[model samples]
Target chain A: MIQVKELLAILIASSLVSNVVLSQFLGLCPFLGVSKKIKTAAGMGGAVVFVITLSSAVAGCIYQYLLVPMNMEYMQTIVFILVIAALVQFVEMFLKKFVDSLYKALGVYLPLITTNCAVLGVALTNVQKEYGILAGTVNGFATALGFCIAIIILAGIREKTEYNDFPEAVKGMPMVLITAGLMAIAFCGFAVLN
Target chain B: MSKSLERLYNGLVKENPTLVLMLGMCPTLAVTTSAYNGLGMGLTTTAVLAMSNMIISMLRKVIPDKIRIPSFIVIIATFVTLMQLLLQAYMPDLYKSLGIYIPLIVVNCIILGRAEAYAYKNPVIPSLFDGIGMGLGFTVSLTLIGIVREFIGGCSFFGNELGWFAPVGIFKMAPGAFFVLALLCAIQNKIKIEGAKKGKDVSKIQSGCNSDCANCAIDCEKRIDDIEITQEDIDSTAKINAAAIEKELAAKGGEK
Candidate 1:
């Protein structure tokens, strides 16, 4: 089906050319903050992945089934934000109840993801692109995957940055931003394919 | 200084949403491919921030504490939608360029953060001015970054072509955004260091609810030092840097 190819393109585009952290800058807060350690970065990325994937699908469905029928196209921002916030909160509670270890890793970040622009951005992009639920879900997953890939790589680099003697002024966030710049440059190779 | 002016100074410099506080990085980095884009995004966010701050401050008493967060989001989102429609109608080019970012502004931490931290607690006028100051701070910083990126990457400023050196294409791309921002932050750190060495008192700044807990507050009384390094954590060089930035922040804080 044509849907399959469309899905593949969305996946490739979001994960590479339009990467959430590197290119689109949707999740820079967590990218810079949590990336201090590989473990935390991976944990945050996993939570975002779960959250974004489900949010895109649910938001897409809500728009298609509910908002469209009610002449409420303008309510997209409010509706999507509420849905994503509720969903993240629910996931946090659900994880706390059933999966203690996973929750511990991602516990604090759950509430944080509610305000993260990426989840909301993905949902909005899904609407703008007019993609069906299936494609939107795929795009959301791929975008979050891109976030993980970039954050994990940055975390690896940051771990190494600990050994190097940074200049007094270039310590902390400045150095990390520079490292991200280099990584973003490497990712730019994908733009050619786009 | 008057209370109203203090709030403006706080948002503009002392607790700048972009530079000092680091509240909203998504649009800050993504849209600064050009100075014009940055200006457009900055002004749009300012309008939304100012309006939402006033509206939220007005409703602060009515909205109960338990549901405040959700209420604030609705208030912010509504303004963002209104701004988007107006922009779409009046300035289609700017609208086209600043597409998803307009909607993304609904989740912009600066607007939501200010609403929760300042507007909810403060009176209507001070909160409104707070929004303006923060919005101006964000605009200035974003414009500066955009100018840097534009000149380096696109070899232009505000869409105006400069008939000079070869444009480094990288500065216009994603990597360029990171590189330019890093360079600016480092320069700022240098200024902060020098200011501290002069033997002056200092205060610090915030962003993001997840990691930078000390700086990003749902309330105004954030303990910035706990989140960032104190005077003791760094050596003489960094200590001086901290003082320098603080001096600047305090001066700005007091300017009003």
Candidate 2:
């Protein structure tokens, strides 16, 4: 059983120290692809937070109730993936019907989240660490927040650099990568908290 | 060259999943803290890729069109789980080091991309070779990145200490991964430019950006059309568009 204080530490640790995108290296596809503007980056982050938190809780329950009880712990990967995929589809439908504005903002991202490794990574991490439903959901939320933070910062940097003159060789992708590297260095400072 | 050999050469050089195509950046950056870890991750992903490609190709006709994506995910997850179990049983050290990344391989875009692009339409044998080619390409690039990071960051070669010079410890960390990759990419871009200047067939080796900024539709003041376009630029853009059209036609032909 994780204490409330330990949960707080996990929230901080997962968000800052071991960031999902910068440190853990999950979800680089969207991190790089959707980070051109701060608005889109924040939108992507919000969608991720919603999806990951819900999926983590759902995946936790399914693993606990379905996989473990059946003594097929080895099937968690397949089960979690299918569950997450189904959950994303359902969430997309739910948002489209009930929350039209949110659906517009997040709908494009929900489909992409299916292939995002961060969601699956957190689900598997929860299982490996043996976190219960509550703890798993909190960790998932924190990890998504970390992804949001990292991408927003990268977007801000990219926006600022959009006008700057760069060397021909370091023009586009390399420049973005180097900026991400510096951000990673800044985030590495959080490791001292541990 | 035979079609299979062409695929092998294409993957190994022309369209490397990691270096050129930039498909699987997650594992490329995370598990490359050391050369050995990179090699292990690369080889493991290769096994999964090859198997998944073969199986998916064999079952292409049986799978329905509307539900192909989920079907691909299920097949990939099954293979990924099998590989995870085997690694856990035999290579616990690597298993521990790689950690969540093993299962995360199911989400690697390169695998799904190939399944959707090549294996779904091609014959079984060529699809199998395509997987191996792409897998080898990914492995080679990863091992190269690993060697560079490990050598610079750890002052070691595959975990053996050299103690010859002071190590740039940053290279071993998260930031170092990005820096090394950026440097490598910049060097690659420089080589491509140099090759283009020499009038070699550098158009075949386009960057991930593809250098066709006009059609990208980004509303930037520095867009390619806003700037003075060169003869070489037009030629390369034409080549890229032609190749793209050829690919689209082939895909349509396959559907029929």
Off by over 4 Å in 2: B195-256
Model 1 per-residue lDDT tens digits across residues A24-48: 8887777877777687678778988
For candidate 1, what is the DockQ-based docking class?
acceptable
DockQ of 2: 0.42
**What lDDT score is found at residue A97 in candidate 1?**
98
For each candidate, report what fraction of the true interface contacts it reproduces.
0.69, 0.63
Residue B121 Cα positional deviation in candidate 1, in Å, after optimal superposition: 1.3
lDDT tens per residue, model 1, B104-173: 9887777777887788999989889999998988998889889989998878989999958999998888
- Evaluated at residue B130, the lDDT of candidate 2 is 89
Determine the TM-score of chain B of model 1: 0.78
CAPRI grade, predicted model 2: acceptable
